[model samples]
Target: MKWFEGSVADAISSAQQKRCLFIVFAADEQPASVSTQESWDSDAVGSVASSSVALKVTPGSDSYTQFTQIYPVTIVPTSYMISPLSGGPLEVVQGTASTDELLAKLQSAQEKLTSAGSAMAANTAGAAPAQASAAATAPAPQTASGAAASTTPAAQQPSNEDKIAKARELIAMKRQQRQEEEKQKDLDSELSRRESGKKLQEYKAQQKSREASDRRKEMQREKDEADRAREEIRRKIAEDKAARRQKQSGSAAASASSEPVSATAAAAAAPSVARPPSLPSDMARIQFRFPDGSSLTEDFSSTTQLSVARQFVADRVSDRFPNGFSLCTTYPRQELTFEVDDQTLQELQLSPRSAVLVLPKTTGKQRRGGSGAGAATALSPDSGVWKIIMIPLLLLQAIWQWLTGSAASSSSPSTPAPSGSQAASQPMPQASSSGDAAEARQRRGRGPETGSSFGVSKEGRVNRFKPNDGGDEDDDMGTWNGNSTQQQ
Candidate 1:
């Protein structure tokens, strides 16, 4: 008879595929006794091994551990019939068995298989009414049905000696079984006690951990309270000192007022620059003196745009200039006009600690009233002032550009040419004038509103307005920006 022998996994796979049993023997056992060899050499035992997957690995090997885990082996030579896929034994035989015992066990397994098939067929066919009634009423059977019952021996009357021997053997088996049960019970109690002890230890550890965490939290809370108490005491001390100083100043004021006129004048003449408290330390200190003689002194952060300063002045004054006013710096004394609305105070380079005059815009340029002590309006997409003024200007400018572009396109040559907007953008061919004395004057009078090519004057004359009168007149000699010289 041939047998397969290898690792646990290999034996298992072959057993499952061949539908056979896996039998293993302990290699560490004292060499097989004569009785064990005789049992193994029997025809029945040899046939069993030949018909199944068989393995005999060393006892203490890694494969042995794996094999023991899959199919429990409390004793060896241990034989287990198993399905390889489940990794568990279906039937187990502990210790060496005689040839007849092994053959009987195999026959019993065959009987069980036949019984399971019969039961399955019976379930599929379902029970008849008569059979169901009979089964419910019938008492238990004395022996197994079919072949099992046929093999069973019938009861017999026995001699006294024979009966005594049988009774003694039965008593011995029952006593052994009772001893094993007591030992199992004691082991179970020990395991339960150990489990309870482990739980207690875990519980005590958790309690200690919680206590440590609580102690840390208490310490942190105490420290925070102490710091707050110290801060409160310091604040109270500062307040008390300030109160005493204020009381002393009140008492000394009247006496000092009578004693210092010349001294006061000297102090006032000193170069002590005043500034707003909120100004950053690095910014220039500036004093704005209005035409009304009222002045504002503030520390100015150089980072703030010049427009912010103009808005600051506008916010404080009585005359509400609608178009916004200009800031004229002193010493160099020039009106801050170029890019006035966009320039930064730092970029304009206004002198530190110097004075500037806040002048109201002239009557004709006043667009709206924006003067008050209220907070300055922040710039946004929907700005109140720009919506009123810029929107109309942008619309008009777009219309003019479109009209010019259309006219240029119509007058372009018949051949395919670039779009009028591109053509208009290209520089026109330069032509020298005949040297007219009025040409300079002609250039000045070219108002942005006039229809002309290359910004030349469309009309030599424009309407002029008198300061006193609200009406306009077509004045030939009037300058365009009022800065151009009139030759007449």
Candidate 2:
């Protein structure tokens, strides 16, 4: 069947204008509904529905809801045949029906509409003859009444038109309102979606930050564990070294105690003392102390000969001791000579760690003090006894010079001139001669002095001071005068 394409209200208006039965079919997507739709589409059902205005509505459509307001659809695949004139339901098919059944229903509803129209037309015809007879019998006054009656329908026609116009306006207003509500719903949904997306981004950022922090913490923890492991290893190694040293010391002491006193003494006096066999045979760390107070440390296998250690020291101190040097230990004060150089360092008790002094070898000529001239040149300036004796004499001489200078300055004009005999007897202050100045310079340079009798002389002898028996003025230079203004 061909269904009306307009809205439900329009379809109803069209049905009324055409004086036909209005048919509405409501259904959802179900097997029964599908069967009913197929039946309506058949040629038999379409032929019967041709005399009616047909409308199809689905469950959620606006037309379906509008139709239901007038004639409620209580079941799926429901059909309603409404009489346009009476605006009442003539037939209702509540469920699925075959094509023949739908066509029979359509025919029955159409016949009802036809009968109602015929009844209304017959009643109108009967009233028309009665109205004509009454008009013919009416007097002059009744004519005015009849004229007013004739204008009544014309006046009511505009009222009907106004009511229809109002109804259409209300429908348009409702449609506009529904459109606005849908727009608002769309906007609200869009805002909610954006908000959800923003929250998701924030959560992702927070997750990344937390993961980075966790990774950094893990790396730091691993580094800390590694450091602790290394520290533990170093501590263990130090403890082992200390324990080994203690054990070696204890063994050495026990072996020394077990030997006889005479043997111990002999060993102590020997140039190369035999080491205890209990000592470790590992590498030896030896420190060589030079005569100049500097030291060198070296490592060697304990089984190496002592001559190697001597050669090692010789190479380092070659500039200082060209002749050679000997190594000796300070504790027992034993010397290591060439005779015992072939012995291993372990046999000499120099294993693990030990200190050896470097002594420059002395020649036979040096031991005998050399020739006289050689001995004299070899002697250093007498720094101890000579400085002690000379410092006091130098202070006294300085005091005497200062006093004489002050006295001469003060008595230049007031003192009377001395007679020849008094002048001759008084010793006058004399400037130091060139020879004495030269000797003073030589003494400052730490060299032997030739002229000075008060300090160390050229022959390395300290000259003694004697009273001047002959009263020589030059010889009296060592004596201090008691009187300030006159010589005593």
Q: Say which candidate scores most in TM-score.
A: 2
Estimate the overall C-alpha local distance difference test score of candidate 1: 0.57
In candidate 2, what are the lDDT values of residues 1-488, reduced to their tens digit? 89999999899999989988898899899999999999999988888788789999998899888877756566788998887766667777878899888878888888888898999789767867777675567564577777886764455333666756765565455446545755786799799999999999999999999999999999999999999999999999999999988997897788678755685576666444345644355989899998778998887999999989888987778989877777899789999989999999889999888999998988877757766555655442343443444455455555654554344333112223333333333444346865664554443322233343333112222222333234444654443222223223
Candidate 2, clashing residue pairs? Answer: none
Reference-based TM-score, model 2: 0.32
- How well does candidate 1 score on lDDT at residue 167? 50
Which model scores highest in lDDT?
2
TM-score of 1: 0.23
